[model samples]
Target: MNVSIPTLEQFREESRAGRLAGRVRLQLPCNLTDFPAEIFSLADSLEILDLSGNALSRLPDRLPELRKLKILFCSDNHFTELPRVLGQCKNLSMIGFRNNRITHIAPEALPPLLRWLILTGNQLSALPSELGHRPYLQKLMVAGNRLQALPQELSLCKNLELLRIAANRFDVLPEVLFKLPRLSWLSYSGNPFCSHNEQTALADTPVKQIPWSSLSLQQKLGEGASGVIYQAVWQSVTPIPVAVKLFKGELTSDGLPISEMAACMRAGIHPNLIKVLGKIGDHPEGVNGLVMSLVDASYRNLAGPPSFASCTRDVYDDDLRLSFSEMLSIVSGIAGVAQQVHANGIMHGDLYAHNILLGQNGDALLGDFGAACFKPTAAAHSHALEKIEVRAFGYLLEELLERYEGEATAGATFATLTHLTALRDACLHIDPTQRPVFTEVVARIRTA
Candidate 1:
């Protein structure tokens, strides 16, 4: 049956006739100007309505009246603002708008009933405060936007489960995002601040225990070549929630399974790295697990590199300064950390903005260690570490400089450039053998 969905009105008329009740899926023109108002009133059993792949500008004004509408797909459009009519739909659970021209959203735009909201690939510079007021928001996918900062109101979301805020224009991510009690999954991949693989592991990963009354969870934080992380709480301690990482793929690159994961648990310690507090033996229910200190924060999806959707010119950060001195400070802070990794004989494979996590006290922690691999005893690992580290650091410096001096030039600042340019160039050198050692680069940065 070629159920031709002519205009929205025709679709509604057919829908009102009841034959289109369970089989109603409409594809509107890319230049569609509005939506069918009568279809919702008659289709008491309507469940899914996909209005994507269109040139629509705004959501239908009468959507709230559709008490039975469940899922709405409104991606690929020219909507500059969030439709106020959306706030009226109390039964609506999911809404998607991945590719659109939306720039700003009013604070109270979404109804408190929304559970899922997808706004990736949009022009939003920031989220509205009303987004947090939603009592049941479960998954928030705002990965590719102009967002430079997250609204402080997100902490109020008691039921937020998964959030992905990857590939954006943020240099620093706020720590408050971790305060939410129900949040468990997050990825913040491409910001300049990430470094350690977003999740850490141990020979034994501890799962924090929480009381049933406290909205606790038993979840898999995810696994890696290093280990698997789980969320749990202490049974005896009551409501003490934490993440437990159990080491796996233990065989070192040398081909011998690492016993050091256990040895290091006994010997190692660091504020930045997860602590290994010994093993809990094998679980009666299944595999062995470990106990460790739980860090206070949630996951952020902020990875990959700068894409076309990465920059947001209209999205401004008040702290932004184009001065070389300021740029130097930023570089200095990052370089200072690189110096430490070099000391520990550890090289951060992915040292970009997204991996960098700024602490509440104004310090930075390199998050996301997915590409972080142990340098083997082989010559290839040692011979090339210097250049690899330099390239990563240099790349970060370049991004900062470009962002700071948007449309401006390094002209007349030759003195400053002259001082750090050699080091920068050395870091960016194609031939790893030509780059300066980490210590040497640090000395030059301080001297400059």
Candidate 2:
């Protein structure tokens, strides 16, 4: 799955042999200060173009020459604004400008068919109303900005499913957002909706804090927007093995690391969750961290992250198919975990196939509390927020059905899949009040 990136020399050789003209992908990092005119020759067939890790300031006016280009990545660039020329790319749908100095976006800068847009880690205070008119805009990442409010027009994007607006200056989430038909995945932590009391709760909670000096760090297991996770040995009296997450402590696209730590501790341990052992204490650099039980090696991610074309949905392999029994078990396990976490006054904000780890016989564990938020157990909107998460669960269930092979066989497995699909549709209703709560979802799946 690792595609080697062609170097400048390799591209030059290919260009000389007339090979570049027919190629579908062109990726290079040549520290460009201006657009590469050489790419225009391949305009007839080019589909994906990656010029990331460059010093480019602006795109050329003739960028529309690449009529077939659909995906463009300009991340880690020096652009002060998103190039308006991008709108001219008639076929361009997915555009990424992450980690740029971009502060301005022209009204017509977006392509007409944009489905996925990544503008993370930028300096934008506002977005153009024209953006809301893109009917196909499904995935949007505007985290790490200084925005005070979202354009109500964005609610008009009925197909929008995944949205990241964390670490912004918003005092309240727009009411229009809650009514979007397909807004299943969302992150609004670090906004004013996140309670100030949650910060005090973490400090006042009576959880055990383990000293950092007592642990020996080993190989890194994984990493995310907030922190790096490592396989470490807790040098206790018995020298036990454990997983340690060292938080960067910076405001991430999801929220603050401290908030994630507090939410994880408050979630408490459940059979289908990653068990938190304690908090890391007395680090030399004073970094916030958490110690948790190491997950077994037999577990692996259920699916890959969303692709450019899928927008908000996770991508599964063509051969990845699950049986009726396995599908039911995984769904029930996750629903049970969500129900428990909600009862403890926490919402796992980022629930997706990528966050789930599957073991032998479909045992599932839901991890990654980076996007989790603390909710008042009796708040009026608490029920609505939980229902929003249920819609996310419906999306997950629908993906499972898409990969299920039982429908064609037409038997008990097919019947069961059909019933579950009905439940998923009910959960995904546009009206939040109509969707079943996690407890109800669990009970229905269990009875089946």
**Candidate number of the best TM-score:** 2
Once fitted onto the true fold, the runs of candidate 1 whose alpha carbons sit more than 4 angstroms away are 1-18, 22-31, 41-43, 195-448
Candidate 2 C-alpha lDDT tens digits along 1-448 = 2122446666667677776667788787877777757788888988999999988898999999999999999999998999999988889999999989999999778999898888988999998888889999988888788888888898889888878887778776567667677887777666666656467558866678898889999999999978999999998878999999999987676677877888888887788999888898798998989999999999999988877667777887778888777788899999999999888777788899989999987799998888887764556667877888899999889888777656545676666677788999988898878999999999888766
Tens digits of per-residue lDDT, candidate 1, 221-292, equal 766545677776755445566666655633221111122233233223444445554455544444444555
The CA lDDT of each predicted structure is: 0.57, 0.84
Residue 12, candidate 2: Cα error in Å is: 5.0
- Indicate the TM-score of model 2: 0.92
The per-prediction tally of clashing pairs is 49, 0
TM-score of 1: 0.42
- 174 Cα displacement, candidate 1 (Å): 1.8
Error of 2 at 185 (Å): 0.4
Instruction: List runs of model 2 lying over 4 Å from the truth.
Output: 1-19, 195-198, 250-253, 376-378, 402-419
User: Which candidate should be chosen as best, given lDDT against the real structure?
Assistant: 2
